[model samples]
Target: MSNYSTTTLVMTRVFNVSREKVFDAWLNPKMMKKWLFTLEGTNKVAQNDPQVGGTWEIVDHRDGKDYRAIGEYLEIDPPKKLVLTFKMPQFSDTVDTITVQLKELEQGCEMTFTQDIIVPHEETWTEADIEKALGEYHDGSEHGWNLMFMGLKELVETGQISYKG
Candidate 1:
């Protein structure tokens, strides 16, 4: 038996738009910055190469700090599914995997997003430290995703960006 556990965040949201539009939002630089990282910051970089084995990098400057994330596309199926490796060096060295699946609906599309993260166990980590780390990670991820999805729904449905910062 292994003494390791995985930290996973699963989220689902339905958008009133075509599957293609919803899918493109994940790759399109303009659409991504509008919804994905609309915080009070300047998007210094939004380079996306949406192809198998292709990599992407985004850097956002906020409040004298830089938040950057880099990833590579593992799988890409148009308007349906995408799998990628995500890493934020500012946070941790561990690389996480994200899987996004889009299903066509009667009115629009439904998106199922999942992020699988491996939280390594360290000899110096106590139980409380582990719990705290896990809780923070989950909360941060959930909050960010929820806000991003809200922006996405608004953008795709109304052709407007709600959160401008």
Candidate 2:
């Protein structure tokens, strides 16, 4: 019985590309700018130092607002596995952990993304508020990641970035 609530989000997508190419997209600044930020914003800043203990940050600007995400690499196994800390300071104060695993298939590579979010308790938050907030966060995260993955697949396969919106 942990005091904090944990929400885990998992998504898997197969890219029609080699494992190395698929893995490189997550770390390469140029590739990340092209596919990683698919929400309403455009990526304004993308910086990545892909190594154990290295940090990365991206800023997306849209509608006169800036959305920033920062993280540090925890574990990096080239073209195979990556574990990192993900934080969106504008949204939440809690830091989340994201683990990405890549497996090479006969045709392409399959990537699995898992995010574990720790929901903190606030004195002013009622049960209903907490539930609603968590639900929205979960849904938004799923949708956003799915869209980004679609863009990633397109970029890695056809060398084009296509966003649904």
Q: What does candidate 2's lDDT look like per residue over 63-161, in tens digits?
A: 788889999999999989999999989987788899999999999999999998778766788888788767777788898898788888888899777
- Report the lDDT of model 2 for residue 2: 37
Please give the CA lDDT of all the candidate structures.
Answer: 0.84, 0.84
- Candidate 2 regions with alpha-carbon error over 4 angstroms: 1-3, 38-41, 124-132
* Clash list (residue pairs), candidate 2: none
| TM-score: model 1 vs. ground truth | 0.89
Cα shift from native, residue 42, model 2 (Å): 1.9
Query: Considering every candidate listed, which one attains the maximal TM-score?
Result: 1
> What lDDT tens digits, residue by residue, belong to model 1 across residues 42-125?
677888899999998888888888889899999999989999999888877778899999999999999999998767667678
Stretches off by above 4 angstroms in model 1 are: 1-5, 38-41
> How many residue pairs clash per model?
0, 0
